[model samples]
Target chain A: MFQTISLFAPQLVLAFFASQLLSTGAFAKRDISIGVRNFSIFVLLIYSVIGFILGKPTGTAFKGALVIDDFSHYMNLIIGLSAAATLALSKSFFQIEKLDRFEFSILVLYCTLGMSIMVSANTLLALYIGIEMQSLALYIMAAFNRDSLRASEAGLKYFVLGALSSGLLLYGASLIYGFTGSIEFTQISEAISYGASPGIIAGMVFLLCGLAFKISAAPFHMWTPDVYEGAPTPVTAFFASVPKFAAMALIARLLVGPFETIVSQWQQVIVIFAILSMFIGAIGALVQVNIKRLMAYSSIANMGFALVALSAGNESGVKGMLIFMSIYVISIIGIFACILQMRIRDGMVENINDLAGLSKSNRSLALVLTVFMFSIMGIPPLLGFFGKFFAFVPAIEAGMVWLVVLALIASVIGAFYYLRLVKIIWGDESSHEFVEAPKTLRTIALMSSLLVFPILILPLISIPTQSLISRAASSLF
Target chain B: MLIAISFYSLAFVSVAAAFMVVASKNPVHSVLYLILTFFSAAGLFILMGAEFLALLIIMVYVGAVAVLFLFVVMMLDVDFVELKQGFLSYLPVGALVAIILLLEMLMVGAAYFAGETKTVVVRDNGVSNLEAFGQVLYTDYAGVFEAAGFVLLVAMIGAIVLTLRKREGVRKQIPSEQIARTKEKGLKMVDIKPGVGIE
Candidate 1:
């Protein structure tokens, strides 16, 4: 019992502090939104450090429901850092919009807790609960600005679609349970190793479909663009980065864990999802005027690339997925931070045209935005190139050369919109006079750009990250 | 034989009440039918020897949920006729959904019968249903149970965060102010001996 409790201490600490923040917000006489937001950031950073320190001891706790290992630790670190960054980014936006509710920070904390549980889940029950917890916070956050009809519609649409996906997941779980007589991933894998059953295959398909929706892969991505466009810029940033990484990590765990034996059955489905997402994400972004909607498509394409690596179904696959997602999260956060700074005299801008001549107005901001765009475009000498390189090599090694080629083509097509944004920022004439961004947001954007740009050149940062990712990936197998 | 008869009767009642729940025009009547359906479902659970589930169905669903539904249906001044105006136009899509559901169920049934899926056997443990349930829930599923608690907490917070607004000019009670009221603040020692004189 002591062992289990100690192994689960990080999550417990997060939940404890979150509840404390909730009560503090509730009882405080004066508005303490800034304090709460800063405190949440502090707590998240502390949690990340603690998770890293506790990364050495890898074991299952609570009768194998929760697995504490390098993989989970890596995911926790990503979730924690990105969550804190998101909170810091939201501070100025909230104040400007008069949404100074301390509950926002507390909800982000709880949402981070949910993602933590998701990455560590070893049982289907834990997985479902974790997903629900995360999604509930997200639904509320999506509609945090309740006065806007678009925000309310986004929330309702997300909730309805999310409920449907949960139902499908539950049905799949029940089917798998019925066929295999267990809900534990280890036991399920054992059962499958004996012999795969038709019911199990169907259940796996259903489960994959549900998970694909959570990751916003194609065919299940109908809700992404609207939700992204309608949500507040900061909330959309949070939506884009942390939850995507968590869901992708969860998918990796599920595929490499219980479904490892039945790879043949699931690989095809993942491939189709990958192909569709790449093409659709690439093609869909061509006509979108809203920058957020374009990002929504970009994320779909990014996940498609991650899925390509995941289709490899080996140690390198997980490693590549983690690396790709980490880089993706960093660049996306930087991009959104830049987006958050797109406010002019009237209000926050969302159109691609709003970025016209940003280079002329705010030189440094434009430079940072250009770097992020190029990085996401997978231009050489940037971090995103390595992310995509690592992702593609594994799939090619797994005899998925055709899929890799297709992905490369899709990425080439996807680069057009990114370059367009750069061109608008640097070449086009100035349209709107942009306001200066908050110090914290500017710092975050610059820092992320630095990470995406010079970190590749600096061996110190790249080597440690590579070693950590490899250890994390090898632990899963 | 007795068990079978009781099962069939409970099932019949439950299905009929469920059908009435959707078919009934009056929202209040629909809520009442929903309660009846819950009751019969609880009865079916009892027949299946899951008394704990039966009690839960009665206590949670019939007792709390159904009552809430009744209150909402009674309190809301919604026009049911206007709401149903699009029913005819939506019938084709609804029917398509119904057909798809029916086919899926049929497919599942066929797969179950044909596939090599083994039925899970319930072992006859000497403990009561509630005790067994508690043991499994608290021991094996303790982590998941705790996580579920967090999910519920998120729901609660989400509800309040989304809907609870402190509007201006709305009179509300301040408990501290009420409690801190002293004799000097609450009571005026002025004696109005005569109403005309006081005026």
Candidate 2:
């Protein structure tokens, strides 16, 4: 049990602290700061150190179903770090809104815990369990604010669509299990590649649909904007960033490892999704007024970029994805942090016009947001530029010139909206009143702002980062 | 042999009930049909030697999800008054789907029957089937399985997110405000006296 306990130690600690605080009635209905955010961050840091200590694939829990590896360990750190950022930013948002205290942080931590397990899965059963755990925690997070009708609506819409996707995935898994007479990922993968059973192909298609939804790729991304718009800003930010990383990892791991040998079919499927996601993400964001919805579209477009990297089906592509996602996640955190800090009067302050004269009010916050927008636009000298570069460089290297070209157009289109946000923030005065963000909110903005500068600090790190990405990619094979 | 028949039967019942579930006009019938489908599927699973999965499906899907449907149907005041029979327009599409399914099944069956294949003898749990699955699961193809699981996990979370959500502008309390008041312990009893009373 101690062995099993070790695999779970990180999450256990989160749960333990959350329970102790919540049960003590300390933060239960009181002023925010249940210390949940701080606790989650500490737990994540601990998990990272422990995971680093464990190094290669090691299992201490769940009878080998829940195992830790370099891939999962690294991702756990990312998820933890991102969750921490989300926590740091959330306090001010809640403070401004005058909403219920920090239970949302606990919810966010729980979801992160689920995602951590998910990335560590070995068997089909473990994989499913991890995913559900992550999703269930997230679902609550999405609708954490009970009073907001839109939030509840977002949760419901996500639930219905998500349920359908899960059913499809389950059906597909069953088919794979049935055909191969096994549910182990490796065995079934071999059965698909060498055997090429019709069941396997069908199963793969079904499974991909579920993956598509998670990544919010097009043709299957209908629910993204609605949910993004409906949920609270920080929760939406979490959706826009962290989950996609895990989803991309999942895609890279599953498709490349198992379906690479049968790339023709899977590649065609991915190509369609990639093309659609890019076009939709770019074109859709063009007219959107809501910042949250705009970010959602941005995420959709980003997923397109990630998928384009994925389409190449190699180690380079995977590395590109990691770099792309890392940078993208930071930029998104910044952008949403700015959005979270906005103190709107009409509950409609999310509109682009509402941001007019922001430059006059909070010049510093305005400037940080500008950097985030540029980064998202893939402008050079910003973190967003490198994310796009790393993701695309591999595609060109893979002889995917056309994809690179289309992606460029999409980037330009993406830039259009991102700059619109820039203009709205720094543009001429439309309103006299300037929204002020609390101290905690400022930190998130600063961190998000700093993400743009990290690229300048070390152009050399990209090489090693790409190397790690490549190694992680090959590890799947 | 027994296992195969039971598996096929369960699958058949589930499929049939699934069709019926959609076809039935009454929500009650639909709910019942779905439950039967789940149970049969569970039975089919049992035949395949996945005791855990078989039991799990029955317990979770049949026992929980389908039962949930039953409760929802029972509770909701649905207006079946305006419902009319629409068999005429739906027939062609239904028949088309059925034919396609039949063709697909025939193709699969034809390949199996026409091709020379060795019979797979059902082994008795192989000393331990769980261990066997676990061994293969952890190695070689672990990545794909994990990815699929992540997909499911995301879906589950997405479902919860989609449903249990709220909107902007609704007033709520700050977590800090709630906790700070309690820690300060502001409710203190102070002693006050008048000069006349003291005398």
Candidate 3:
């Protein structure tokens, strides 16, 4: 019992502090919203540090319900940092939108706790519970601005769809349990190693469908655009970055751990998801006017690329997925930080055209946005190119050359919108005079852009990231 | 023979009630049918020798959930006629989905029974069902049990955060302020003239 608790101490402590913060917010006489937000940020950073210090302790807790491995630790670190960065970026946006409730910070904390649990889940039950916990917090955060009808609609849509997906996931889990006679990943793998029944395959497909919805992969991505468009910008930023990594990590664990032997059965499903997501995400974003909606599609496409790596079903595949998502998360945070700074005297502008003449008005901000755009477009010498390169190489080696070629085509098509964004920011005439962004948001955006920019040095940042990710990925096998 | 008869009867009632739940036009009637369905399902569970699950179904679903549904259906003034307006247009797609689902379920059932898959059943340990459930839930599944608690906590917080709005010009009771009132503040002794109504 002690060992189990110790293994999960960071998440336990984070949840306790989150509850404490909730009560403090409820009881405090004066408005201490900023203090609470800052405290949550501090706690998140500390949680990440503690997880790093407790690096890769190989063990299982609660009788193999949760796994403590390098993959989980690395993913948790990324989740924690991105969540903190999200909270930090949210401060100014929350104040501007009159959404300075302290519950927001506490909810983000709990959401992070849930994601940490998700990446470490070793049982179907844990996966379902963790996803629910994360999603419940997210639904509330989506409608944090209760005064807006769109926000309420977004929350309702997300809740209804999320409930359906959870139902499908539970049904799949029950089917797997009935067929395999166990919920433990190891036992299930053992069961599959003998032979996979048709029932198990159906369950796997249903489970993947549900998991794909979480990552906003195509055919299950109906809710992403509306939710992204309607959710508050900071909340959308959090939605875009941290949860994607957690879900992807969970999927990778599921694939590499229990479903490794049944690769032939699931590989085609993943391939279809990848091809559909790439085409749909790339095409869907072309006509989108709202920057948030475009990002929604962009994320779908990015997950497609990650899926291509995952379809390889090997250590390199997981490595590439992690590295690609880490870089993607950073770039997304930078983009959202720039988006949050798009405030004018009237209100915040969300249209792509609204970025017109930003280069002349806010030269540095435009430059940061440009770097992020190019990075996401996977331009050579940028960090995103290396991410794509690593992700695609494993698939090519795995005899997925045709898929890579198609993905490249999709990405080429995807680049047009990104370039359009750049053109609007730098080329078009200044239409609206924007107010200055907060120093913290600007600094975060600048730092993220700098991280995405590959410094021409002997040891590039990707080298260290690759090494760490390879270690994490190898732990799964 | 008696157990089989009772099981069939209970199953029949439950299935009928479940169908009525979706087919009934009145929402209140639908909720009542839902409770009936729960009761019959509980009966079926009892027939299967799972008394603990049966009682749980009655206590949790029929007792609390059914009552809540009754209250909501009664209190909310939703227009059922307007809601059913699109039923005709949506019938084809709904029926197609229902048929596909039925076929898939049949296929799964066929596959399960025909294949070499064998369900591993736990041998009887001479303990009550509730005790056995508790043993695993608190011991083996403790992590998941605690995590489910967190899920509920998030749901509670979400409900309160989304709906609990503070409105101005509303009088509220402050127990601490009331308790802290001094005798002088609460019970001021006043001397009044005979005909002076405290103007």
All candidates' lDDT scores?
0.90, 0.73, 0.90
TM-scores of the models, in the order given = 0.91, 0.81, 0.94
DockQ comparison, 1 vs 2, better candidate: 1
Error at A433, model 1, angstroms: 1.2
C-alpha lDDT of residue B170 in model 1: 85
Give the residue spans of candidate 2 off by over 4 A.
A1-33, A53-64, A345-348, A454-457, A460-470, B1-13, B42-65, B81-121, B125-199
Cα lDDT tens digits for candidate 1, A69-182: 999888878899999999999999989999879999989999998998999999999898889999999999999999999999889899999999999999899988988898
RMSD per model, one decimal: 3.3, 8.5, 2.6
How much does candidate 1 score in TM-score?
Answer: 0.91
Candidate 1, superposed: residue stretches over 4 Å from native: B1-44, B66-104, B115-117, B168-199
Ranking by TM-score: 3, 1, 2
**What would the per-residue lDDT of candidate 2 be over residues A1-477, giving only the tens digit for each residue?**
555556656655655654464444342555546465566567656655565554444453554455555566667767778877877777666655666455566566556666776676655566566666667666777776767899889887887888888787787777666666666566666766656656567778888988788889998999999999998887888899888888777777678755667877787788789889999999999999888888899899999998888777777787788888888888888788888777755442678787887888878877888888877788777777878888888879878899889999888888888888787777668575644567777887786688676654485965665555565666666
List runs of model 3 lying over 4 Å from the truth: A1-5, A456-460, B23-25, B120-123, B173-199
Which prediction has the highest TM-score against the true structure? Answer: 3
Which scores higher on TM-score, 1 or 3?
Answer: 3
- Residue-wise C-alpha lDDT for candidate 2, range B17-108, written one tens digit per residue: 99898888789999999889888877876676767677878889887888898999999887675444566678899999989977866765
DockQ of each candidate, alpha-carbon based: 0.60, 0.09, 0.73
lDDT of model 1 at residue A61? 85
> How does chain B score by TM in each prediction?
0.77, 0.61, 0.81
